[model samples]
Target: MLEKLLPIQKNLNEQPQNPDSSPEESNTSPNLLESFKDDFFESYSFVNKATLILKLFILILPGVFFFMLALNDALDRKIMALEDDKNVLTDELFVYPDVQAIHTSVVLREQILKQVNEKEHYAPAMLDSIIKSLPEGVSIKNEMVQGKTASLILLSPGPLNVASFITNVLKDDFAQEVSILSANLVMTQNIYEIELVVRYR
Candidate 1:
């Protein structure tokens, strides 16, 4: 029985194996191995990309933070400097009333000088008018000006001439007030001497 079983086993083992099955199994094993290798490489590449991104973030994050910190520091310093300047200016303004007073005085002086110049410009024209208004028998002996006031000593042939001079002076637009301070009849020269004071508006 053993001998008969051995022959049967030999025959079964010797029977022609399926030639296509070996090649197909061999091809499938290699394909599966190649697919596994490709999958492993793909996973490694993804992990490498993730690691590279993490490294880049780690590298750049501190630089960005430090840059922001430096910018903030610079702004703070600039703000502090501006505040210091403002404080200094405020302190100077607080400490110096004299400077303000001097500026005010200068402005006032300029205004006064401008007014004086304007008044002086009209003086010659006013003098011409006064001279033209005088009567033929009257002449100005002496004239003095102090600020807006005028003092005139007039020599007139008669009281009428003196009165005419006063009337003419009073009629002037620039004259605020006019007064004959004194009128004296001079017998030696047969003339009337009049002292007139005129005030300008």
Candidate 2:
């Protein structure tokens, strides 16, 4: 309620001032240094977990790597041993003198069969047909079978007998082809000698 009067005060302009900093910034200076120290020195929780994971990987990696290598080496040796045993067994089988020859013969037979594609086996029916077709005066002298073909030497009283036999043989279903290889007259025996080939279907 008194009348306004001028108050005595110090001259603040005479003192040096920091134009860049406020009172609020001056109060936070010490706290900034403390925060910097914490950031530099402290470990974060995520960083600790990552470091643990890295350590586990380092400890386990070499053991797993070496174990895999050893397992592979053992498998290789086992395979080699099996191969050696197989070779030895194969060789031992051939110790019987005829085994190798038999094997070779079988292999050759298979190759021949595959190439020839011959499917028929001469049965009793074939023998019956041949015997039935032969005339009474005609006789089969020598007979040999090779694959799908048969060769025979015959003694016939006359050429007519041979022709009749050939005609009868060709009438049978079991014969696919027929050929006469030779014909000769035997003066001493008074018989005609004939060679014949028959191919079966």
Candidate 3:
């Protein structure tokens, strides 16, 4: 046993005193750390590239979508405004006929009033002339005065009386032109009907 122990002791004395200190572990540690650093840098670079792309996508995509959405909203609002204007125009068009009618009636009324005012001054003299020239047997049935023209419907007992009435009207100084529109014998009333149109100077 003592002889076996002596060899073992000799082998033990040839070895290093510190069991934890190893040259191989010291040499391999730096290489492993370097490899780990290289791997970390590669991964970090890839991650940074991915992050940049993601950030760009995040920034631009939402902005593009928002712009498109805003444009659509603006177009929609414009269409609605146009529709509202069209409806208003349509409503006005619907009411236009009544407005036009009222305007036309007012114009016609004004024209009638203007004509009446213009002829008022000559009405008394024309009536006086007509009355004085009328024959004794001729009776006026209807008389219409318009502008410078007068229409008279006379009822006479005979053709001679009607002829005499027309002759008397033609001799009047106030008349510029006189025309016998119609002369008809009314068998029912046994009278001659004379229609005359006269124009004043």
Tens-place lDDT digits, model 1, residues 1-201? 588788766755654564655543334332456544446546978889889999999999999999999999999999999999999998988888698889999999999999977755556656765787798889999988766777899999898887787678778888788788998889999888899887877
| Candidate 2 weakest ten by summed lDDT | 2-11
Taking all chains together, the TM-score of candidate 1 against the true structure is 0.43
* Model 3: residues with Cα > 4 Å off, grouped in runs: 1-120
Candidate 1 wrongly placed segments (more than 4 Å): 1-120
Residue-level error in angstroms, candidate 3, position 89 = 53
lDDT of 2 by residue, 9-81 (tens): 1223322355676555444333566445445226688688888999999989998999999999999999999
Q: All candidates' lDDT scores? A: 0.80, 0.81, 0.81
TM-score of each: 0.43, 0.46, 0.40
Worst 10 residues of 1 by lDDT: 22-31
Better of 2 and 3 by TM-score: 2
Task: Provide the RMSD of all predictions against the true structure, rounded to 1 decimal.
Answer: 12.4, 10.9, 16.4
Candidate number achieving the greatest TM-score relative to the actual structure:
2
Q: What lDDT tens digits, residue by residue, belong to model 3 across residues 1-201?
A: 589788766755655665786665334332456544446546978889889999999999999999999999999999999999999999989977688889999999999999978754666777777777887888999998776788999898987887776677678777788788898899999898889898888
